[model samples]
Target: MWLMWIYRILILNHEISMASIEPIILGLEGTAHTAGVAVIKGREVIVNESATYFPPQGGIHPREAAIFLAKEFPILIDKVFKRLPFKIDKIDGIAFSQGPGLGPCLRTTATVARAISLRLNIPLLGVNHCIAHVELGRTVTPVDDPLVLYVSGGNTQLITFLNGRYRVLGETLDIAIGNALDTLGREMNLPHPGGPHIEKQAQSGNKLLTLPYTIKGMSFSFSGMVTAAKKLLHDHSIPDVCYSFQEYTFAILAEATERALSCTKKPSVLLTGGVAANAHLQTIIQKVAQEQDTSFQAVPRNLAGDNGVMIAFAGTHLFNTGKILSVEDSQVKPRWRTDQVQVGWIE
Candidate 1:
């Protein structure tokens, strides 16, 4: 009887200690080309690990990408737990990128996340991928309630927190800007991943080639611009085409983002996602945001791309606001829309 009472007292004290400690969340990111794992306690990310796979040629094959993610995710899982840096297990939740991504990759990631959640018997959260990018920017920067510009390989949009959701004021009607850039890189046969090469070669560009620029209201189209730029290869130099391509695309995106700023009446502008890391695009958006008298925030280079940190950070907020998902309800949302998710995390 004495030993049992002692054990009960110790267990109760341990629970009280955990209650005094800030909660933590482990996030799984398997949205597209990257498979990542992150651990965050409160607002700080203590572990952010990821592995990326870029195809040797052409666009990403969904099944192949999914296979690669499946292989790498287990490795990442091992590394994350091995390097936790602490013994505290206050892992209050498990969050995963639940939608708006390649179907195969999304499913693969969700499967792993569900296994972890079930094994731990904790609440799970299904987070929107694009919204994760935006939240990560806000978390790592000094901006609050900014007009968010998210540009990644699979997405492009201008969003802001308004009313009760992340409102999309503008977006790509055709191809995402990052996709367009990578496609142009492929056409030139410069490299498998062409974004940086395009930027480097564009530095020597002395002239701008005339390219198609399509915009309808707040939405823009990059397919026509990419096609037009590709056609210029025979007539114009690669450097010139690349320069003009960046110029035209950046201009249109800047225009749309500018429109969102005015309409949203936001106090700051934050840029995030993989394509937001481009030096040229950063320059363009920074100038635009400053011109409008709104502060601009660029997510740190490391956190800008698709990573698990964003998922965990966003998930923590959602979990605190009473969001929970059962095992059966934790399915992947391959085409989940950002605006469709009820934003209970942010005020």
Candidate 2:
């Protein structure tokens, strides 16, 4: 009788293992100045899409973008869903950015996601915007804990993990790195979103115009450097300024990374966000890591820019931890911090 019971128990376990696995959640990322969506099955992203909007004149036009997102999101969501092998209803829950982005854009995304949850009678999970950005990239990048320098139009500076959360070890005291680059690029008559343009120009030129590289304690400042670059450009060639600007900015970034590494006593580093796409920055980071014999990880170009896949992966992690969101929970936050999040979330 005892032997027969053991056989039955083993057979039941086999049957359970054979049952189909369903996706844990659907992730929506609208925190980007550009909008995006990603579907995740556990920790793996299945479909991710982003629509980048270039301002007609200068800077992001909030009303224009809100209208754009409202019009474009449904189509993009449909496209992503169609690519999925299974039905959306099969998803265990829905996740959307809760805060830390353009208010109008955030509301538009939240409204749509909430409507989906209400219509489908499914639960929803709200995510912190900036936390999602860093976490999503970190999940895929190999860099463990040395430091994360996130430079973009809206944000810049140093990040480190501590007490089970990512903390802002240091950051820009003024304008973000991407903004400075773009502003300088504009002065050079380069196109909008000019970080790439500056980098391209620098490849053909040598550093002629010098710029300041500042690191005050754990934080750094970019306004002075931006001012100096603009002044120098009138007397110097554009390419030369571009080369020197890249060198100066990257040097400050590398110095901050090294400082963070030493302070935290960690040996791994990760580069993320839009600015991480710069080849020059990558070279500098790799060089510094090598000097310290530290490990470095950078997100691939596809994942570097803001996209939905990171949201999906983040949602997947949160879902498995029982942090699921309900329909009543659908809300947007314009300022959410990464370190405020509690760990022990899903794997």
Best by TM-score: 1
Off by over 4 Å in 1: 1-21
The weakest ten consecutive residues by lDDT in model 2 span 15-24
Task: Supply candidate 2's per-residue lDDT for 150.
Answer: 79
Q: Work out candidate 1's RMSD over C-alphas.
A: 2.9
Predicted candidate 2 versus true structure: per-residue lDDT over 164-242, tens digit per residue: 7778888888988888998888788888898999999998877566567788987888889988999998788888889
Best by lDDT: 1
RMSD of each: 2.9, 3.4
Cα error of candidate 1 at position 245, Å: 0.3
The lDDT for every candidate, in the order shown, is: 0.87, 0.77
138-195 per-residue lDDT for model 1 (tens digits): 8789899999999988999988888899988889998898889989999999875677
